[model samples]
Target: MCSWMVSSYFGSILYSEMPFNVEIKAKVSNASQLAEKASQLSQSEGTVIHQQDTFFNCSLGRLKLRDLMDGNGQLIFYERPDCGGPKLSNYSISNTPDPEGLRAVLADALGVKGKVKKERRLFLVGQTRVHLDTVEGLGHFMELEVVLKEDQSLEEGEVIARSLMKDLGVREDSLVTGAYMDLLLEAQG
Candidate 1:
């Protein structure tokens, strides 16, 4: 069941301290090539992350707990439009010291919606974070998260996103509309 729930739980997320996230996501046919291209533009070694994101049922917003193989975990809540283009995602992430305990708590409290497992290759390009993902049930995908500075405007973020899109060879038609959890739910049906 594909769902986007909006909840009053937004206040529970650490929105006051976190920066606004401007981002875009696209399905990549050639993730390796795109990673190579991103690497060429930015001289940085990509970090490989094996992650599992477990979503929970909420009343108003999307909430998920992301557990990384590196032992770091986070509980994330975000409210963003499901548009197939560049969009500003209002989100908050709180680091978890006990991911296993929290996962069990959230599962028993809200009920688990779905889970998404992926191996992500992350690269940094100036203000943007590039992710080349190979999902377990899905496939290859690329996501760009442009972290906006305190003084930066949304338009500026869009400009940066567009430039990176062109550089990374991401096409408008390849953009996806919802979260990976949504896709996973749809695939199940």
Candidate 2:
């Protein structure tokens, strides 16, 4: 049987200044197959991204510096439900051209929590992004992030997310709550 991890306390911090969304995270048994299926149904072929997310220790919310292999990065702060299914996530993101410098500052200010490295195949279906991930040491996982506009409702996003979940053959039973960093932390403990 597959194991699951709940969201950490730090996972529940969102900047009030940012956008909100209905996000779903699940374990994928066959990520390549799912990606193939998604390519057939999606508007375009997904883009592949290799990313290293270094999480920091924070009292309020989850903070991570995401350094993409392309030299672009983002400082992400987020809050979301820790339950094992589709849920609401609030987050703020700031783009950074200097990831190494920021990483040093963050590490000095807040100790490193952990880091997660993954090769992500991201497909866009409407406003939602379907992620097929191969995470280092952790194996495969899938994520659905349905971005909600100012005019959009959480219920609407949830409906879209659920429908996409079905289209992607994502099993509700395989759903996981929390971020990848949280999963790594849980594995350590």
Candidate 3:
């Protein structure tokens, strides 16, 4: 059964991007060459990233939820097939990473607000095969994403993501993103 719970109070997410998130996948001879290209920018420092999407195993429209760590702004989120709210606002920014213990430290530094909204989501991007997203909660979102390839290490992508999150404005202790089913259930009328 699907239920549209309005969340007694209200839950929201605040996010932004650096520069359109330039997607690049080129063949390089070695790590050195890759490094040269990944960080080669006119006036910006860039990195090579391979997105290991964790949407679903089979189901055409499969999405998931994750807990988020807060940063500058009071927000947390992750990719979902859909999401919703009053939509108070939306924007992007330069992000920073958060280390393993950052969340604990955040408890002392930053403060959280509002109660987390329990929701039921609906992922209506596709039905069968093919990969093209008609995301909800506006065009689409890039929440808790693994940076993929950061600096020369395997887990560097996550590190970079954390850094960007901090530099941008994401809090260290926040629900990364809620279940799409929850969001959709709320909007279903």
Candidate 4:
């Protein structure tokens, strides 16, 4: 198995623009042929998710597992379900102190507010995860994913992301172009 600590933030959108997010993790590669074998893991699975409400986190630290850093800020994303379109809502514990306290510290500094939601998941892949979600009276969603190709160059990572999105039948129209965290907030008010 290959690995590169991966981290990113799912942010809220404002005026149909960008969202607020901050996270950092090494994108570890998990064996090469994995992407070519994504279909094999697409079995119908299920589970119940849990989410801790969003809070202002402003701390700095590092992971005891890999080479993750908090050099910059990103919007931390809560776990989301994987379904017809990326899970619009699901269980997630943002501000993870992942070896590097980037999320907690940045979230507070950015000063953006986020809400939390949870539900039963219905997907899984080997050690990967799959879940189902419904944004409280907003919409339903699903998302399935394998790990990122490790140590791949920035260009390679972008290619993997776009290619996987296409192979999985993600629609250009349905794609939100931003984190559901921002979408939910927009729809809520």
Q: What is candidate 3's local distance difference test score?
A: 0.27
Task: Itemize residue pairs with steric clashes in candidate 1.
Answer: 5-60, 5-61, 6-59, 6-60, 6-61, 7-60, 7-61
Residue-pair clashes per candidate, as listed? 7, 1, 37, 43
Can you write out model 3's per-residue Cα lDDT over 30-109, one digit (the tens) per residue? 33332232233112343222121112222222322122333222213332222221111112332335322433444345
Show model 1 residue runs off by greater than 4 Å. 1-18
lDDT, each prediction: 0.83, 0.83, 0.27, 0.36
Task: For candidate 1, write residues 83-150 as lDDT tens digits.
Answer: 67777777778998888899999999999999999999999999999999999888999998899998
| TM-score: model 2 vs. ground truth | 0.90
Candidate 3: residue 8 lDDT (0-100): 17
TM-scores of all models? Answer: 0.89, 0.90, 0.25, 0.42
Which ranges in model 2 have alpha carbons more than 4 Å from their true place? 1-15
Q: What TM-score does prediction 3 earn?
A: 0.25
Per-residue lDDT value at 145 in model 4: 36
Candidate 4 off by > 4 Å: 1-40, 44-46, 55-112, 120-131, 144-146
Local distance difference test, candidate 2: 0.83
Sliding window of 10 residues with minimal summed lDDT for model 2: 1-10
Better of 1 and 3 by lDDT: 1
User: Please, what are the lDDT tens digits per residue for candidate 4 over residues 127-168?
Assistant: 334334454544554444333333334344334444545544
- How far does residue 106 in candidate 3 sit from its true spot (Å)? 45
Ranking by TM-score: 2, 1, 4, 3
